[model samples]
Target: MRKRATAKEVADAAGVSKWTVIRAFTPGASITEESKRRVLEAAAVLNYTPNLLARSLATNLTHQVAVFVDDFANPQKLPFLETLTERLQAEGLVAVLININNHFDHVHALLNADQRQVDAVILFGTAFRNETLSDRQLGRGMPPMFVLARDSQIDGVPAVVCDAELALRDIVDHLYERGYRRPGFMTGAPALSTALRRRQHFIDFWKGKGVDEIAILSADRYSAEAGAGSVRHYLNDIDPAARVDVLMCENDILALGAMDEIRGNFGLRIPDDIAVVGFDNYELGGASCYGLTTYEQPRIEMVQAVIGMIKGRLEPETVTLPGKLVVRTST
Candidate 1:
């Protein structure tokens, strides 16, 4: 291994105190401009990389924020991350992405925070209302935590939430006002916050109309194929006498997939036999094949709002963003 240069060597080369070299690396540390320039010059000449851990102990700040996201595989999360990173960069803070599959992984960040590897932590996509996030281990922290999801307020962490119920209600009311009934739902899991809100919206709407039952299906993946497969399952399982008049997919992919399966396999006409509605009206939903009726929540606005919450230094609180529904040919 190559011999590593030390801070003492840089201090000798720059003709300054060892503490002077440390202050240059620490954010908001008081140091003369001339001294900082000398340290930078000495560091360049000696090819020295500052020991971030030691500096973190000196300042009690790592200046690096850890971001916990469900998984990058979900396309919807990518944009949110990109926007958040841009904002974090603008604030002169590093955003480190940590994939959250294990519940106890968040605790690791706290350990890192103490060591000055990561400062604050931001959690994305997954809600904290469930047991995994509500647990004391996951909630306690050395670094402040912020959740980016709908219906947040997980234990100790403040939430950057969305108005999912209002969004769903608006979409449902729009369809109902347009003289549509017998709406069905497609969702994969009951535990997810977004899925629960959408699924319950259909129930409350129909129950208010004196309807006894509403057709529903569970999806495995948030993809077009999953949507298509879910519709197939519903078709095979539902009673022929009380088929769904409309399908309200929890996401755009499902709405588009169900529409394709309905058109290609079952040979049913859309908006005639059944109208379809979906959320997150992504590019696929807007495609000519789907032209899906869906709710377009302030996607970019939501991203900005969460980033804003994260950017706020020490003054942490909950933030709620608005959403809107759009009518298309599918309805």
Candidate 2:
């Protein structure tokens, strides 16, 4: 087997001590400029890869950030992670993704640094609960955290989120202005803070427009099946006198599903019997069958803002952005 070149060998070639060669690999370590340059040049000539474990132990930093997400395949999360990965890479940092299978337990692991490998954390989830990550932890010796989709009022931690309340209010007003009354609502999981806020704002906005009786359905998840089920529940469960003229879903898939249910199950004409709107505006929501009217989240702005927060422009904390509504065939 070929002998790997060690720090000692690099140091000999550079005319520096092995300790000096080691220092080049350590970030924030006390080392002279000249010595650091010579050590790096020698290491390059020797084709040396620094010992990551050793450097991590010495500097007390892994130069790695952990991003927590529920479903990576979800369209909403993909853009954020891709943008963050690119930004972090430009800064010579590695991003480690932690799949949040179990919310409570997985969140605990991401926050605590028993291994000392993670420098910071980013999450797409709503809020970390008291049992998962407490206020004490937020105030203590915890590394920086960037939370997306929640407010920035968690102690001093930074958050990058879209203003759900404002977005929903805007959407509701747009629909109302378009002469859409008897608005029906298909809301998402109440546990999610953003979802709850959007639902409340949507209802309040409808009520403000003189919509006395509203059709509202609750769904278990944000999926096509849930969307279809919510519509069915609305058609079956509601009183015959109360009819829904406009359907507003909290997600694109749900909107698509509701559109399907409205056509197939109820034999109703879309936009003729009921107009529909959705959030996130997934491609499927804009299918030929269901050109869904929905809000396009400022994906670019949100991504850039989060990158800026990670880049240290906005003091690493939660930042909420706004969204715009687009009309479609469904409406």
Candidate 3:
């Protein structure tokens, strides 16, 4: 194999010092236009490219972020990750995606990104523990860390999340206005902090309204199939007269699944027999077939907030955005 060209070779070919070659390649370094042009010409001739890893070592910034995610089956995670990567790319940053299944995996991913000199780390899933993030036993010198979509507080870590408690209040109010007295919640897993909070919020909101009876069911996963299976099981045992008037799914995908089961398998009319609602107003939720009544989770706002935290525009504290309701044919 041919030996790779070095900055020294480019400098020699350009008739300039190696310092001039380095400055010319640097984004905002002080260099004369003529020298930069000559350096560019020499680099082109030699097919020389700056070593980003070496540059990061010298500057102490990689312009690379590590994103830790889980639950590949969740329909919303892909879109959320895509939006995050695109926004980071727009700001001249690169994203390295790491799929972690549990808290131990999260720790490993963090350590690995730190070793690789990542500028920041973002947790895009629900399995990480807030306490584990700040444990002193972990190695020192971690990059700026954040959690998205879920609210968690570590001393130096911030989370950009929608206000789920407040959002559930809006959902409860809407359900009440629509004459839904008996409501139920369908969640993927109760182990997740986000899911637990959302579940409790629904129960507390309904109890506060003097509605003592409510049903809550947890699916094995967040997939549409799981949603359909859980709903099917939920309806089998309940008496027809005591059935839940409204079923509030934890997310749009789950709601979509439940809606399909109710219409397709159970042969029930939406909004007439059972009004269905969901959160995270996914794109398909607004389609003509579903027209789901769901909460609008501010993805753009959360992404921008994460970027601000990465750039030090915002402090390391949780930022909660309000939720908006989109009423459609579902409710």
- Per model, how many backbone clashes are there? 1, 6, 0
Q: Per-residue lDDT tens digits of candidate 2, residues 1-331?
A: 9777898899999999998887788678799999999988988999987877677787677878777766443455565567778877877678877776655454466555435567777766543543446534444566676666555444555666678888888888888887887887887654432223667788888888788677678877666888889889888876745768898887787788888898999898889878888888676766677788898777667767766666567666556787777778887
lDDT of 2 at 28: 83
Candidate 1 regions exceeding 4 Å error are 1-5, 25-28, 47-49, 69-73, 100-117, 125-142, 192-196, 205-213, 239-241, 299-315
Question: How accurate locally is residue 242 in candidate 3, as Cα lDDT from 0 to 100?
Answer: 84
lDDT of 1: 0.72
TM-score of 2: 0.82
Decoy 3 TM-score against native: 0.92
Candidate 1 vs 3: which has more lDDT: 3
Superposed Cα deviation of residue 172, candidate 2 (Å):
1.6
Displacement of residue 113 (Cα, Å) in model 3 is 2.1
lDDT of 3 by residue, 1-331 (tens): 9888889999999999988988998989999999999999999999999877777878898999999877778888877888899999998789998888644476777788888889999888766766667566566678888889886645666788999889999999989988899999998754443233787899999999999899887787778898999999988978888889899998888899999999999899999999999888889999999999999888989998998889788886888898798899999
Which candidate has the top score in lDDT? Answer: 3
> Whole-model lDDT, candidate 3?
0.85
Of 2 and 3, the candidate ranking higher by TM-score:
3
Which candidate number would show the highest TM-score if scored against the true structure? Answer: 3
